[model samples]
Target: MACVGESNGLTFWVAEQKDYEDVMSISVNIYGGNDYLPHRYSDWMTEPDRVVILGRKDSKLVALESGFVVDEGRTLLVEGLRVCASERGRGVAGEIQRFADQYMQQLYPTLRTKRQTMSDYHSSESTKSLAKFTELGRRAILSFTGDGKSFNGFISHLKNKLNSTTGLDKAVSVQQMVPLEDAHHLKNILLDPELPKRVQLPGGVIIQDWQPFQPIKGNLEILARRNLTWLVNKLEKPNFLSFYTPPYPIAFDGGSLRFNIDMFGTDLDSAKRAFVSHFEKVMEKGLLTGKIMIHVFLDQSLWKEMKEFCAGETGLKLWREYWEQVIMERDVRGGAEGKRESNM
Candidate 1:
């Protein structure tokens, strides 16, 4: 492991297999113990394309950071970074950020962007604000708008919608995304062996099996590359949906699955059908029955119908909210600034 200098007598170095335990052991103190690491943590830990670094004060590991090369070497994504409670005020994070800058400089000389996302904030509390602050000079893409309903009487209320067709003539294909080895559904979409599952970022950094239903915009790859997409489907027209379960199960109760939907036209009916179908499948698999949610911006044309359908539909609820706004910032090619120390 390469040593990345020191701050306040704390030494940071590139993480190796032996450092895994030390890194995993470092969690926010607010919780006493880390609940669970995100799925990406496991993926990056094992993936050859990613890098994991750790900081130590003598024999005790105190800070950690994981990043991956994207778009070839033009961008370095600091996927996960954390400093233990004891080292928070010591500038250990700052030292590692500087080291990352130097480390990438030698190998990826043309590195243009170093990006991260709010989605990576698994155990931290300042996730929302951290994301909002990171948009300063970087391009932000509207990820999703989320809405959810309680499972108090979901099963009973879902019968009518399941039996009656809205004459909408819409069909949606949903599959639960699971690890390749643990996957059981024969109808899995990611199982297709022939298609190009991974997308190549700008710098020739290829994201293994990082396939999306369609090519994501260049700037949006930061969000796409980190999370694995399992179930994906095209809506009736001008709409899309993709379901992602981070590398690990998260949240309380059995954890929740996250899905993103793009509603660009008047296909709210189809969207609803697709959502219910997906929800039913998730329930059938017993993936989650607690509270499921989605992110979407309703089109004005379908607002009335959606409002009525949601009000009348017993199983589903519509929440008018934007998960996040994608704000585009000027590309800062010169080593971007380090993310401020946040509890997120």
Candidate 2:
């Protein structure tokens, strides 16, 4: 085993294939028992231009952090940051973060920034920590709960509401989903170089299932690997777009499945149609069971309307209150630590 760094009784090691069990042991009740680390840990081990650093004390796992090189190697996207429950107050998170930053600097000397998404970002020290970071963009997150049995009801309710809207603007002209594997069409839309600044995207950042990535070729290629279902209202210069990531088992509500649907655009009608189409597609997959936690990330303007529609129509409970997933970045220089170099 290669030890990367050791200091003050804590040792940092590059995560190996055999350390999965030990990592799982330290992660308890993370993300309210729906932690994504457990499901994606193995995949992170094999992903290119990524590194998972394990922090240990006396040869025992105490923390885990991962950095994915994105934005064409100029930025390091931090994810799966966790500290052992027993070691929380000992500055474990800060240490692991510093370790990952230094290691990445050494590995990728051209690195200019360290980026992170703020969801679990809200800790007791959220306000103070946030003050040091620059906000890139954020999307409103609304979480709902239902299952395969209630999926059809949810769609029906959405359609019924769409049908009865007296306000002509409530009418959704398009409810049909694009072909799942329309390779040529998807490439055409995504190939647009200006996807970053498009008004459809929040703050010009394309966030897939809580992971914020710049809409560039390298990042787009990274998103392509995930078995995501891409849907848009049109094939050319589309006004509506959404991404549906496959459901995976969670440790909440008797092993419920969690599905993430990221909708981009402010049109209420198109957003409503997106739910119908995405839900139907998920139904066809037949992967859902018992309780399904659906987290919808969309424009803030559509949050209240969509929430009211879903709650009043389908009667699904909220997995959590309304939250915003903001992407924050801090500038990095040669051999930087977790310290704030400058507010970017």
Give candidate 1's error at residue 214 in angstroms. 10
What tens digits encode model 2's per-residue C-alpha lDDT throughout 52-169? 9999999889999999999899999898888889888787887788778888999998899888887733733566656657887778888988767877776777666776773434
Q: Which numbered prediction scores highest in lDDT against the true structure? A: 2
Question: How much is 66 displaced in model 1, in angstroms?
Answer: 1.4
Model 2 score (lDDT): 0.79
Question: What's each prediction's TM-score?
Answer: 0.55, 0.91
> Which stretches of candidate 2 lie above 4 Å from their native place?
120-124, 166-174, 177-180, 313-315, 334-344
Candidate 1 lDDT over 1-344, as tens digits, reads: 56766766777677766665666567634221223444345656676556677778887988777666655455566646778776776667776765665665666667666555433223155443354333421111122212244532553344344345433222432232222222333123222332222211111121222211222234234444444333323311122333433322334234544443333223444545544554455455555534444433333345455444445434445533222222212233442343332333
Q: Give candidate 1's error at residue 171 in angstroms.
A: 15
In order, the Cα lDDT scores of the candidates are 0.44, 0.79
Best by TM-score: 2
Candidate 2, position 109, lDDT: 87
Error of 1 at 244 (Å): 3.0
